[model samples]
Target: MPYVEVSLPVRAERSEIYPILKEMEKYPEFMADLVSVEVVERKENSTITKWVSNVDGRIIKWTEVDLFDDANMHISYKQIDGDLKKFEGEWILTPVADGTEIKLTVDFEFGIPMIAGLLNPILKKKVRDNSLNMLTAIKERMENRA
Candidate 1:
Protein backbone atom coordinates (compact mmCIF):
# COMPACT_ATOMS: atom_id res chain seq x y z
CA MET A 1 0.00 0.00 0.00
CA PRO A 2 1.11 3.56 -0.69
CA TYR A 3 -0.16 6.67 1.01
CA VAL A 4 -0.14 10.25 -0.31
CA GLU A 5 -1.19 13.38 1.51
CA VAL A 6 -1.44 16.92 0.19
CA SER A 7 -2.75 20.12 1.74
CA LEU A 8 -3.42 23.67 0.63
CA PRO A 9 -4.52 26.81 2.40
CA VAL A 10 -7.57 28.48 0.99
CA ARG A 11 -8.56 32.08 1.62
CA ALA A 12 -11.90 31.12 3.02
CA GLU A 13 -13.54 29.81 6.14
CA ARG A 14 -14.09 26.11 6.78
CA SER A 15 -17.84 26.53 6.80
CA GLU A 16 -17.71 28.29 3.45
CA ILE A 17 -15.59 25.51 1.97
CA TYR A 18 -17.38 22.43 3.36
CA PRO A 19 -20.41 22.76 1.13
CA ILE A 20 -18.30 23.06 -1.98
CA LEU A 21 -16.39 19.94 -1.04
CA LYS A 22 -19.65 18.04 -0.64
CA GLU A 23 -20.48 18.80 -4.24
CA MET A 24 -18.30 16.03 -5.64
CA GLU A 25 -19.95 16.08 -9.00
CA LYS A 26 -18.80 19.64 -9.56
CA TYR A 27 -15.17 18.68 -9.18
CA PRO A 28 -14.74 17.88 -12.83
CA GLU A 29 -15.56 21.45 -13.73
CA PHE A 30 -12.38 22.67 -12.10
CA MET A 31 -10.24 19.58 -12.04
CA ALA A 32 -8.79 18.79 -15.45
CA ASP A 33 -7.64 15.32 -14.46
CA LEU A 34 -11.12 14.32 -13.32
CA VAL A 35 -13.33 13.22 -16.16
CA SER A 36 -16.50 12.87 -14.10
CA VAL A 37 -18.01 12.18 -10.70
CA GLU A 38 -21.53 10.88 -10.39
CA VAL A 39 -23.51 10.43 -7.24
CA VAL A 40 -24.94 6.92 -7.37
CA GLU A 41 -26.65 7.13 -3.98
CA ARG A 42 -27.16 9.78 -1.36
CA LYS A 43 -27.67 8.97 2.30
CA GLU A 44 -28.20 11.11 5.38
CA ASN A 45 -24.54 11.42 6.11
CA SER A 46 -22.86 9.60 3.29
CA THR A 47 -22.86 9.21 -0.46
CA ILE A 48 -21.89 6.52 -2.94
CA THR A 49 -20.16 7.97 -5.97
CA LYS A 50 -18.72 6.73 -9.24
CA TRP A 51 -15.58 8.43 -10.48
CA VAL A 52 -13.61 8.49 -13.72
CA SER A 53 -10.24 10.19 -13.73
CA ASN A 54 -7.28 10.44 -16.06
CA VAL A 55 -3.86 9.85 -14.58
CA ASP A 56 -0.99 10.50 -16.90
CA GLY A 57 -3.36 9.74 -19.79
CA ARG A 58 -4.46 6.42 -18.26
CA ILE A 59 -8.09 6.26 -17.31
CA ILE A 60 -8.92 5.02 -13.81
CA LYS A 61 -12.43 4.36 -12.59
CA TRP A 62 -13.85 3.66 -9.16
CA THR A 63 -16.97 3.63 -7.02
CA GLU A 64 -16.63 4.88 -3.47
CA VAL A 65 -18.61 5.53 -0.33
CA ASP A 66 -18.05 8.94 1.21
CA LEU A 67 -18.80 9.58 4.85
CA PHE A 68 -19.36 13.17 5.78
CA ASP A 69 -18.70 14.75 9.15
CA ASP A 70 -20.17 18.16 8.67
CA ALA A 71 -19.53 19.40 12.15
CA ASN A 72 -15.84 18.72 11.86
CA MET A 73 -15.62 19.61 8.19
CA HIS A 74 -14.23 16.21 7.33
CA ILE A 75 -14.97 13.51 4.81
CA SER A 76 -13.73 9.93 4.68
CA TYR A 77 -14.06 7.71 1.65
CA LYS A 78 -13.26 4.15 0.63
CA GLN A 79 -13.67 2.28 -2.58
CA ILE A 80 -16.47 -0.27 -2.68
CA ASP A 81 -15.51 -1.39 -6.19
CA GLY A 82 -12.79 0.08 -8.31
CA ASP A 83 -9.82 -0.53 -10.57
CA LEU A 84 -7.45 -0.58 -7.63
CA LYS A 85 -7.32 -3.31 -5.00
CA LYS A 86 -7.76 -0.76 -2.21
CA PHE A 87 -8.37 2.98 -2.33
CA GLU A 88 -9.30 5.06 0.66
CA GLY A 89 -8.61 8.38 2.31
CA GLU A 90 -10.02 11.42 4.02
CA TRP A 91 -10.37 15.18 3.56
CA ILE A 92 -9.89 17.42 6.52
CA LEU A 93 -10.57 21.13 6.83
CA THR A 94 -9.10 23.18 9.63
CA PRO A 95 -9.61 26.86 10.24
CA VAL A 96 -6.51 28.97 10.72
CA ALA A 97 -5.90 32.63 11.50
CA ASP A 98 -5.64 33.56 7.84
CA GLY A 99 -7.91 31.01 6.22
CA THR A 100 -8.72 27.30 6.05
CA GLU A 101 -6.25 24.52 5.51
CA ILE A 102 -7.57 21.65 3.45
CA LYS A 103 -5.83 18.33 3.55
CA LEU A 104 -6.45 15.35 1.27
CA THR A 105 -5.07 11.87 1.71
CA VAL A 106 -4.99 8.78 -0.48
CA ASP A 107 -4.11 5.20 0.40
CA PHE A 108 -3.98 2.59 -2.32
CA GLU A 109 -2.66 -0.75 -3.41
CA PHE A 110 -1.77 -1.84 -6.94
CA GLY A 111 -2.57 -5.46 -5.94
CA ILE A 112 0.30 -7.13 -7.71
CA PRO A 113 2.70 -8.05 -4.96
CA MET A 114 5.34 -9.48 -7.30
CA ILE A 115 5.84 -6.18 -9.10
CA ALA A 116 4.90 -3.92 -6.18
CA GLY A 117 8.50 -3.05 -5.48
CA LEU A 118 9.09 -1.91 -9.03
CA LEU A 119 5.87 0.04 -9.50
CA ASN A 120 5.11 1.54 -6.10
CA PRO A 121 7.48 4.47 -6.44
CA ILE A 122 6.15 5.56 -9.80
CA LEU A 123 2.59 5.02 -8.70
CA LYS A 124 3.17 7.01 -5.53
CA LYS A 125 4.44 10.00 -7.45
CA LYS A 126 1.47 9.95 -9.77
CA VAL A 127 -0.92 9.68 -6.87
CA ARG A 128 0.80 12.53 -5.09
CA ASP A 129 0.64 14.71 -8.17
CA ASN A 130 -3.03 13.90 -8.61
CA SER A 131 -3.80 14.69 -5.00
CA LEU A 132 -2.00 18.00 -5.22
CA ASN A 133 -3.87 18.88 -8.37
CA MET A 134 -7.17 18.16 -6.63
CA LEU A 135 -6.27 20.34 -3.67
CA THR A 136 -5.10 23.15 -5.90
CA ALA A 137 -8.28 23.05 -7.89
CA ILE A 138 -10.42 23.24 -4.77
CA LYS A 139 -8.38 26.08 -3.36
CA GLU A 140 -8.71 28.05 -6.55
CA ARG A 141 -12.43 27.50 -6.78
CA MET A 142 -13.00 28.58 -3.20
CA GLU A 143 -10.75 31.59 -3.26
CA ASN A 144 -11.98 32.86 -6.58
CA ARG A 145 -15.56 32.68 -5.36
CA ALA A 146 -14.85 35.23 -2.67
Candidate 2:
Protein backbone atom coordinates (compact mmCIF):
# COMPACT_ATOMS: atom_id res chain seq x y z
CA MET A 1 0.00 0.00 0.00
CA PRO A 2 1.09 3.55 -0.65
CA TYR A 3 0.34 6.09 2.05
CA VAL A 4 0.09 9.83 1.86
CA GLU A 5 -0.70 12.15 4.74
CA VAL A 6 -0.93 15.91 5.01
CA SER A 7 -1.70 18.30 7.84
CA LEU A 8 -2.52 21.90 7.17
CA PRO A 9 -3.58 24.75 9.44
CA VAL A 10 -6.36 26.74 7.90
CA ARG A 11 -7.52 30.12 9.17
CA ALA A 12 -11.13 29.06 9.39
CA GLU A 13 -13.17 28.05 12.38
CA ARG A 14 -13.96 24.36 12.75
CA SER A 15 -17.68 25.01 12.45
CA GLU A 16 -17.19 26.84 9.19
CA ILE A 17 -14.74 24.29 7.81
CA TYR A 18 -16.65 21.16 8.67
CA PRO A 19 -19.57 22.06 6.44
CA ILE A 20 -17.37 22.45 3.41
CA LEU A 21 -15.64 19.21 4.25
CA LYS A 22 -18.98 17.44 4.48
CA GLU A 23 -19.84 18.50 0.97
CA MET A 24 -17.73 15.87 -0.72
CA GLU A 25 -19.98 15.96 -3.74
CA LYS A 26 -18.52 19.32 -4.65
CA TYR A 27 -14.90 18.18 -4.76
CA PRO A 28 -14.72 17.86 -8.55
CA GLU A 29 -15.60 21.53 -8.89
CA PHE A 30 -12.60 22.86 -6.94
CA MET A 31 -10.07 20.05 -6.83
CA ALA A 32 -8.30 20.20 -10.20
CA ASP A 33 -7.73 16.50 -10.78
CA LEU A 34 -11.18 15.47 -9.64
CA VAL A 35 -13.19 15.26 -12.82
CA SER A 36 -16.50 14.16 -11.35
CA VAL A 37 -18.02 13.10 -8.05
CA GLU A 38 -21.58 11.93 -7.46
CA VAL A 39 -23.30 10.94 -4.29
CA VAL A 40 -24.98 7.67 -5.15
CA GLU A 41 -26.45 7.15 -1.70
CA ARG A 42 -26.60 8.95 1.59
CA LYS A 43 -27.70 7.83 4.99
CA GLU A 44 -27.91 9.56 8.34
CA ASN A 45 -24.19 9.86 8.85
CA SER A 46 -22.66 8.18 5.83
CA THR A 47 -22.52 8.78 2.11
CA ILE A 48 -21.44 6.74 -0.89
CA THR A 49 -19.73 8.80 -3.52
CA LYS A 50 -18.39 7.73 -6.90
CA TRP A 51 -15.54 9.72 -8.31
CA VAL A 52 -13.54 10.03 -11.49
CA SER A 53 -10.13 11.65 -11.32
CA ASN A 54 -7.59 12.49 -13.99
CA VAL A 55 -4.12 11.59 -12.84
CA ASP A 56 -1.25 12.04 -15.27
CA GLY A 57 -3.94 12.53 -17.94
CA ARG A 58 -5.26 9.06 -17.29
CA ILE A 59 -8.80 8.65 -15.97
CA ILE A 60 -9.14 6.64 -12.78
CA LYS A 61 -12.41 6.14 -10.94
CA TRP A 62 -13.46 4.83 -7.55
CA THR A 63 -16.39 4.55 -5.17
CA GLU A 64 -16.06 5.11 -1.45
CA VAL A 65 -18.41 5.15 1.49
CA ASP A 66 -17.66 8.04 3.81
CA LEU A 67 -18.53 7.76 7.45
CA PHE A 68 -18.94 11.15 9.01
CA ASP A 69 -18.50 11.81 12.69
CA ASP A 70 -19.92 15.22 13.34
CA ALA A 71 -19.19 15.31 17.04
CA ASN A 72 -15.54 14.40 16.67
CA MET A 73 -14.89 16.29 13.41
CA HIS A 74 -13.75 13.28 11.45
CA ILE A 75 -14.47 11.67 8.11
CA SER A 76 -13.38 8.11 7.36
CA TYR A 77 -13.78 6.30 4.08
CA LYS A 78 -13.10 2.90 2.56
CA GLN A 79 -13.37 1.78 -1.01
CA ILE A 80 -16.32 -0.33 -1.95
CA ASP A 81 -15.24 -0.63 -5.58
CA GLY A 82 -12.72 1.10 -7.74
CA ASP A 83 -9.86 0.89 -10.25
CA LEU A 84 -7.71 -0.25 -7.35
CA LYS A 85 -7.46 -3.26 -5.09
CA LYS A 86 -7.46 -1.41 -1.80
CA PHE A 87 -8.10 2.22 -0.88
CA GLU A 88 -8.97 3.61 2.53
CA GLY A 89 -8.39 6.76 4.50
CA GLU A 90 -9.62 9.37 6.89
CA TRP A 91 -9.86 13.11 7.31
CA ILE A 92 -9.43 14.40 10.83
CA LEU A 93 -10.22 17.90 12.02
CA THR A 94 -9.23 19.36 15.35
CA PRO A 95 -9.90 22.80 16.67
CA VAL A 96 -7.03 25.21 16.95
CA ALA A 97 -6.83 28.77 18.14
CA ASP A 98 -9.15 30.66 15.83
CA GLY A 99 -8.69 27.93 13.19
CA THR A 100 -8.83 24.23 12.46
CA GLU A 101 -6.08 21.70 11.88
CA ILE A 102 -7.09 19.35 9.09
CA LYS A 103 -5.32 16.11 8.33
CA LEU A 104 -5.88 13.80 5.37
CA THR A 105 -4.56 10.29 5.23
CA VAL A 106 -4.84 7.94 2.28
CA ASP A 107 -3.74 4.34 1.74
CA PHE A 108 -3.93 2.96 -1.75
CA GLU A 109 -2.79 -0.02 -3.79
CA PHE A 110 -3.22 -0.54 -7.52
CA GLY A 111 -3.80 -4.27 -7.01
CA ILE A 112 -2.27 -5.14 -10.36
CA PRO A 113 -0.52 -8.45 -10.50
CA MET A 114 3.26 -8.91 -10.67
CA ILE A 115 4.28 -5.31 -11.34
CA ALA A 116 2.75 -3.84 -8.20
CA GLY A 117 6.06 -3.42 -6.38
CA LEU A 118 7.65 -1.83 -9.40
CA LEU A 119 4.96 0.84 -9.58
CA ASN A 120 4.90 1.55 -5.87
CA PRO A 121 7.31 4.46 -5.92
CA ILE A 122 5.51 6.23 -8.75
CA LEU A 123 2.13 5.72 -7.10
CA LYS A 124 3.47 7.01 -3.79
CA LYS A 125 4.54 10.30 -5.33
CA LYS A 126 1.25 10.68 -7.15
CA VAL A 127 -0.70 10.14 -3.97
CA ARG A 128 1.39 12.65 -2.07
CA ASP A 129 1.05 15.27 -4.77
CA ASN A 130 -2.64 14.73 -5.12
CA SER A 131 -3.19 15.05 -1.39
CA LEU A 132 -1.29 18.30 -1.27
CA ASN A 133 -3.22 19.66 -4.21
CA MET A 134 -6.51 18.81 -2.56
CA LEU A 135 -5.52 20.48 0.67
CA THR A 136 -4.37 23.61 -1.09
CA ALA A 137 -7.59 23.85 -3.04
CA ILE A 138 -9.69 23.52 0.10
CA LYS A 139 -7.68 26.10 1.96
CA GLU A 140 -7.97 28.58 -0.85
CA ARG A 141 -11.69 28.09 -1.19
CA MET A 142 -12.43 28.25 2.48
CA GLU A 143 -10.32 31.29 3.15
CA ASN A 144 -11.84 33.16 0.23
CA ARG A 145 -15.41 32.24 0.95
CA ALA A 146 -17.92 35.01 1.40
Candidate 3:
Protein backbone atom coordinates (compact mmCIF):
# COMPACT_ATOMS: atom_id res chain seq x y z
CA MET A 1 0.00 0.00 0.00
CA PRO A 2 1.11 3.55 -0.70
CA TYR A 3 0.00 6.57 1.31
CA VAL A 4 0.16 10.28 0.65
CA GLU A 5 -0.87 13.13 2.91
CA VAL A 6 -0.80 16.87 2.44
CA SER A 7 -2.01 19.79 4.54
CA LEU A 8 -2.60 23.29 3.26
CA PRO A 9 -4.13 26.52 4.51
CA VAL A 10 -7.14 27.77 2.61
CA ARG A 11 -8.59 31.22 3.12
CA ALA A 12 -12.09 29.86 3.47
CA GLU A 13 -14.49 28.92 6.22
CA ARG A 14 -15.53 25.41 7.12
CA SER A 15 -19.08 26.18 6.04
CA GLU A 16 -17.94 27.25 2.61
CA ILE A 17 -15.47 24.47 2.10
CA TYR A 18 -17.70 21.67 3.30
CA PRO A 19 -20.35 22.14 0.63
CA ILE A 20 -17.84 22.37 -2.16
CA LEU A 21 -16.11 19.25 -0.94
CA LYS A 22 -19.36 17.32 -0.86
CA GLU A 23 -19.97 18.26 -4.47
CA MET A 24 -17.06 16.24 -5.75
CA GLU A 25 -18.62 16.00 -9.16
CA LYS A 26 -17.69 19.62 -9.78
CA TYR A 27 -13.99 19.09 -9.37
CA PRO A 28 -13.37 18.05 -12.99
CA GLU A 29 -14.06 21.62 -14.02
CA PHE A 30 -11.37 23.13 -11.84
CA MET A 31 -8.87 20.34 -11.33
CA ALA A 32 -6.32 19.42 -13.93
CA ASP A 33 -6.63 16.05 -15.65
CA LEU A 34 -10.05 15.36 -14.10
CA VAL A 35 -12.20 14.83 -17.15
CA SER A 36 -15.60 13.93 -15.71
CA VAL A 37 -17.51 12.99 -12.60
CA GLU A 38 -21.05 11.76 -12.10
CA VAL A 39 -23.10 11.40 -8.98
CA VAL A 40 -24.40 7.85 -8.96
CA GLU A 41 -26.26 8.08 -5.67
CA ARG A 42 -26.57 10.55 -2.84
CA LYS A 43 -27.98 10.38 0.67
CA GLU A 44 -27.66 12.51 3.77
CA ASN A 45 -24.00 13.51 3.91
CA SER A 46 -22.89 10.63 1.70
CA THR A 47 -22.66 10.04 -2.01
CA ILE A 48 -21.45 7.58 -4.59
CA THR A 49 -19.50 9.30 -7.36
CA LYS A 50 -18.15 8.00 -10.63
CA TRP A 51 -15.01 9.70 -11.84
CA VAL A 52 -12.92 9.68 -14.99
CA SER A 53 -9.47 11.18 -14.75
CA ASN A 54 -6.86 11.48 -17.46
CA VAL A 55 -3.35 10.50 -16.51
CA ASP A 56 -0.56 10.16 -19.02
CA GLY A 57 -3.09 10.25 -21.81
CA ARG A 58 -5.02 7.33 -20.36
CA ILE A 59 -8.44 7.74 -18.83
CA ILE A 60 -8.78 6.02 -15.47
CA LYS A 61 -12.24 5.55 -14.07
CA TRP A 62 -13.42 4.84 -10.55
CA THR A 63 -16.44 5.00 -8.31
CA GLU A 64 -16.11 6.04 -4.71
CA VAL A 65 -18.35 6.53 -1.69
CA ASP A 66 -17.83 9.85 -0.01
CA LEU A 67 -18.74 10.18 3.66
CA PHE A 68 -19.05 13.71 4.96
CA ASP A 69 -18.72 14.67 8.62
CA ASP A 70 -19.94 18.22 9.16
CA ALA A 71 -19.26 18.50 12.85
CA ASN A 72 -15.63 17.55 12.41
CA MET A 73 -15.27 19.31 9.08
CA HIS A 74 -14.07 16.13 7.48
CA ILE A 75 -14.90 13.85 4.57
CA SER A 76 -13.70 10.32 4.00
CA TYR A 77 -14.02 8.08 0.96
CA LYS A 78 -13.34 4.56 -0.20
CA GLN A 79 -13.41 3.11 -3.68
CA ILE A 80 -16.51 0.95 -3.91
CA ASP A 81 -16.05 0.27 -7.61
CA GLY A 82 -13.18 1.18 -9.83
CA ASP A 83 -10.35 0.14 -12.14
CA LEU A 84 -8.01 0.11 -9.21
CA LYS A 85 -7.89 -2.67 -6.70
CA LYS A 86 -7.86 -0.46 -3.61
CA PHE A 87 -8.25 3.22 -2.91
CA GLU A 88 -9.32 5.11 0.22
CA GLY A 89 -8.79 8.47 1.78
CA GLU A 90 -10.04 11.30 3.94
CA TRP A 91 -10.19 15.08 3.89
CA ILE A 92 -9.82 16.84 7.20
CA LEU A 93 -10.58 20.51 7.82
CA THR A 94 -9.42 22.29 10.92
CA PRO A 95 -10.39 25.86 11.64
CA VAL A 96 -7.40 28.16 11.82
CA ALA A 97 -7.19 31.85 12.68
CA ASP A 98 -9.45 33.36 10.04
CA GLY A 99 -9.38 30.44 7.61
CA THR A 100 -9.15 26.67 7.56
CA GLU A 101 -6.39 24.08 7.51
CA ILE A 102 -7.29 21.35 5.06
CA LYS A 103 -5.55 18.00 5.03
CA LEU A 104 -5.96 15.20 2.52
CA THR A 105 -4.76 11.67 3.06
CA VAL A 106 -4.80 8.99 0.39
CA ASP A 107 -4.10 5.29 0.67
CA PHE A 108 -3.88 3.25 -2.48
CA GLU A 109 -2.75 -0.07 -3.75
CA PHE A 110 -2.34 -1.07 -7.36
CA GLY A 111 -4.20 -4.09 -8.71
CA ILE A 112 -1.12 -5.84 -9.95
CA PRO A 113 0.93 -6.89 -6.95
CA MET A 114 4.08 -7.70 -8.92
CA ILE A 115 4.25 -4.27 -10.51
CA ALA A 116 2.99 -2.33 -7.51
CA GLY A 117 6.37 -2.36 -5.82
CA LEU A 118 8.12 -1.27 -8.98
CA LEU A 119 5.64 1.52 -9.63
CA ASN A 120 5.50 2.82 -6.07
CA PRO A 121 7.88 5.69 -6.65
CA ILE A 122 6.11 7.06 -9.70
CA LEU A 123 2.71 6.41 -8.20
CA LYS A 124 3.66 8.43 -5.14
CA LYS A 125 4.44 11.43 -7.31
CA LYS A 126 1.12 11.21 -9.10
CA VAL A 127 -0.80 10.94 -5.82
CA ARG A 128 1.00 13.95 -4.39
CA ASP A 129 0.38 15.98 -7.53
CA ASN A 130 -3.28 15.02 -7.53
CA SER A 131 -3.66 15.96 -3.88
CA LEU A 132 -2.05 19.35 -4.33
CA ASN A 133 -4.02 19.95 -7.48
CA MET A 134 -7.24 19.24 -5.60
CA LEU A 135 -6.40 21.73 -2.85
CA THR A 136 -5.36 24.35 -5.36
CA ALA A 137 -8.63 23.95 -7.20
CA ILE A 138 -10.60 24.26 -3.98
CA LYS A 139 -8.77 27.39 -2.95
CA GLU A 140 -9.10 28.99 -6.36
CA ARG A 141 -12.83 28.31 -6.60
CA MET A 142 -13.81 29.34 -3.08
CA GLU A 143 -11.71 32.49 -3.14
CA ASN A 144 -12.96 33.60 -6.53
CA ARG A 145 -16.61 32.92 -5.71
CA ALA A 146 -18.93 35.90 -6.00
Candidate 4:
Protein backbone atom coordinates (compact mmCIF):
# COMPACT_ATOMS: atom_id res chain seq x y z
CA MET A 1 0.00 0.00 0.00
CA PRO A 2 1.07 3.57 -0.68
CA TYR A 3 0.16 6.44 1.57
CA VAL A 4 -0.10 10.11 0.70
CA GLU A 5 -0.85 12.99 3.01
CA VAL A 6 -1.37 16.65 2.20
CA SER A 7 -2.28 19.59 4.38
CA LEU A 8 -3.37 23.15 3.94
CA PRO A 9 -4.07 26.03 6.30
CA VAL A 10 -7.35 27.78 5.82
CA ARG A 11 -8.31 31.09 7.33
CA ALA A 12 -11.61 29.76 8.60
CA GLU A 13 -13.10 27.90 11.50
CA ARG A 14 -13.34 24.12 11.51
CA SER A 15 -17.07 24.48 11.90
CA GLU A 16 -17.29 26.31 8.64
CA ILE A 17 -15.01 24.02 6.72
CA TYR A 18 -16.43 20.78 8.07
CA PRO A 19 -19.73 21.29 6.36
CA ILE A 20 -18.07 21.87 3.02
CA LEU A 21 -16.00 18.75 3.43
CA LYS A 22 -19.01 16.75 4.46
CA GLU A 23 -20.72 17.71 1.24
CA MET A 24 -18.56 15.55 -0.97
CA GLU A 25 -20.85 15.99 -3.93
CA LYS A 26 -19.72 19.59 -4.27
CA TYR A 27 -16.12 18.63 -4.77
CA PRO A 28 -16.43 18.35 -8.53
CA GLU A 29 -17.32 22.00 -8.74
CA PHE A 30 -13.98 23.02 -7.30
CA MET A 31 -11.69 20.12 -8.13
CA ALA A 32 -10.98 19.64 -11.80
CA ASP A 33 -10.00 16.00 -11.65
CA LEU A 34 -13.17 14.98 -9.86
CA VAL A 35 -15.89 14.16 -12.35
CA SER A 36 -18.65 13.48 -9.82
CA VAL A 37 -19.46 12.42 -6.31
CA GLU A 38 -22.86 11.08 -5.39
CA VAL A 39 -24.20 10.25 -1.97
CA VAL A 40 -25.63 6.78 -2.28
CA GLU A 41 -26.67 6.55 1.34
CA ARG A 42 -26.70 8.89 4.29
CA LYS A 43 -26.87 8.15 7.99
CA GLU A 44 -26.66 10.17 11.17
CA ASN A 45 -22.89 9.90 11.38
CA SER A 46 -21.78 8.33 8.15
CA THR A 47 -22.40 8.23 4.43
CA ILE A 48 -21.79 5.98 1.48
CA THR A 49 -20.58 7.91 -1.53
CA LYS A 50 -19.91 6.89 -5.10
CA TRP A 51 -17.08 8.70 -6.79
CA VAL A 52 -15.84 9.09 -10.33
CA SER A 53 -12.52 10.82 -10.79
CA ASN A 54 -10.05 11.32 -13.58
CA VAL A 55 -6.57 10.34 -12.52
CA ASP A 56 -4.16 11.44 -15.19
CA GLY A 57 -6.70 10.91 -17.93
CA ARG A 58 -7.72 7.50 -16.61
CA ILE A 59 -11.14 7.22 -15.05
CA ILE A 60 -11.38 5.58 -11.66
CA LYS A 61 -14.64 4.79 -9.97
CA TRP A 62 -15.34 3.72 -6.43
CA THR A 63 -17.86 3.63 -3.63
CA GLU A 64 -16.80 4.27 -0.09
CA VAL A 65 -18.21 4.73 3.37
CA ASP A 66 -17.37 7.96 5.12
CA LEU A 67 -17.48 8.21 8.88
CA PHE A 68 -17.80 11.69 10.25
CA ASP A 69 -16.69 12.77 13.69
CA ASP A 70 -18.28 16.15 14.02
CA ALA A 71 -17.03 16.85 17.49
CA ASN A 72 -13.41 16.38 16.49
CA MET A 73 -13.86 17.73 12.96
CA HIS A 74 -12.52 14.54 11.47
CA ILE A 75 -13.57 12.15 8.71
CA SER A 76 -12.49 8.59 8.01
CA TYR A 77 -13.29 6.72 4.82
CA LYS A 78 -12.80 3.18 3.53
CA GLN A 79 -13.65 1.70 0.19
CA ILE A 80 -16.39 -0.90 0.16
CA ASP A 81 -16.06 -1.61 -3.56
CA GLY A 82 -13.72 0.05 -5.96
CA ASP A 83 -11.16 -0.24 -8.76
CA LEU A 84 -8.46 -0.65 -6.18
CA LYS A 85 -8.01 -3.54 -3.81
CA LYS A 86 -7.77 -1.21 -0.84
CA PHE A 87 -8.44 2.48 -0.39
CA GLU A 88 -8.85 4.17 2.95
CA GLY A 89 -7.86 7.34 4.72
CA GLU A 90 -8.88 10.14 7.02
CA TRP A 91 -9.20 13.88 7.06
CA ILE A 92 -8.22 15.77 10.17
CA LEU A 93 -8.90 19.39 11.02
CA THR A 94 -6.82 21.00 13.71
CA PRO A 95 -7.07 24.48 15.09
CA VAL A 96 -4.28 26.92 14.38
CA ALA A 97 -3.50 30.38 15.64
CA ASP A 98 -5.00 32.06 12.62
CA GLY A 99 -7.53 29.46 11.58
CA THR A 100 -7.58 25.74 10.84
CA GLU A 101 -5.13 23.25 9.42
CA ILE A 102 -6.74 20.61 7.26
CA LYS A 103 -4.99 17.37 6.50
CA LEU A 104 -6.01 14.75 3.94
CA THR A 105 -4.57 11.27 3.72
CA VAL A 106 -4.88 8.47 1.15
CA ASP A 107 -3.83 4.86 1.59
CA PHE A 108 -4.25 2.55 -1.36
CA GLU A 109 -3.03 -0.48 -3.20
CA PHE A 110 -3.37 -1.27 -6.90
CA GLY A 111 -3.54 -4.97 -6.02
CA ILE A 112 -1.20 -6.02 -8.80
CA PRO A 113 1.77 -7.67 -7.20
CA MET A 114 3.59 -8.39 -10.44
CA ILE A 115 3.85 -4.78 -11.59
CA ALA A 116 3.59 -3.09 -8.23
CA GLY A 117 7.24 -2.16 -8.18
CA LEU A 118 7.01 -0.47 -11.56
CA LEU A 119 3.76 1.44 -11.08
CA ASN A 120 3.77 2.33 -7.38
CA PRO A 121 6.02 5.33 -7.80
CA ILE A 122 3.99 6.84 -10.62
CA LEU A 123 0.73 6.08 -8.85
CA LYS A 124 2.02 7.58 -5.62
CA LYS A 125 2.90 10.83 -7.35
CA LYS A 126 -0.49 11.04 -8.99
CA VAL A 127 -2.21 10.39 -5.67
CA ARG A 128 -0.09 13.00 -3.94
CA ASP A 129 -0.86 15.54 -6.61
CA ASN A 130 -4.55 14.79 -6.39
CA SER A 131 -4.51 15.04 -2.61
CA LEU A 132 -2.77 18.39 -2.79
CA ASN A 133 -5.23 19.60 -5.36
CA MET A 134 -8.11 18.64 -3.07
CA LEU A 135 -6.61 20.49 -0.10
CA THR A 136 -5.84 23.51 -2.24
CA ALA A 137 -9.34 23.56 -3.66
CA ILE A 138 -10.87 23.44 -0.20
CA LYS A 139 -8.58 26.12 1.10
CA GLU A 140 -9.35 28.40 -1.83
CA ARG A 141 -13.07 27.81 -1.52
CA MET A 142 -13.10 28.61 2.19
CA GLU A 143 -10.79 31.58 2.05
CA ASN A 144 -12.63 33.12 -0.86
CA ARG A 145 -15.85 32.90 1.09
CA ALA A 146 -14.47 35.15 3.81
Top candidate by lDDT: 4
Error of 1 at 83 (Å): 0.6
Of candidates 4 and 1, the better by lDDT: 4
Error of 3 at 106 (Å): 0.7
Task: Please give, for residues 27-126, the per-residue lDDT of candidate 1 as tens digits.
Answer: 9999999999999999989999999999989999999999999878899999999899999999999888889999999999999999999999999999
RMSD of each: 0.9, 1.1, 1.2, 0.8
Q: TM-score winner among the candidates?
A: 4
Error of 4 at 98 (Å): 1.1
lDDT of 3 by residue, 6-57 (tens): 9888899988898888888888878888999999999998999999998878
Error of 2 at 121 (Å): 1.0
Q: Residue-wise lDDT of candidate 2 within 1-146, one digit each (tens)? A: 78889988899987888888889989888999999989999999999999899999989899999999998878999999999999999998888886888899999888986998899889889988998899888899988988
Q: For candidate 4, which ten residues in a row score worst on lDDT?
A: 137-146
Cα deviation of 130, candidate 1, in Å:
0.7
**C-alpha TM-scores of all predictions:** 0.97, 0.95, 0.94, 0.98
Error of 2 at 116 (Å): 1.6
Q: Rank the candidates by TM-score, best first.
A: 4, 1, 2, 3
Model 4: per-residue Cα lDDT at residue 145: 79
Q: Enumerate residue pairs that collide in model 1.
A: none
Error of 2 at 40 (Å): 0.4
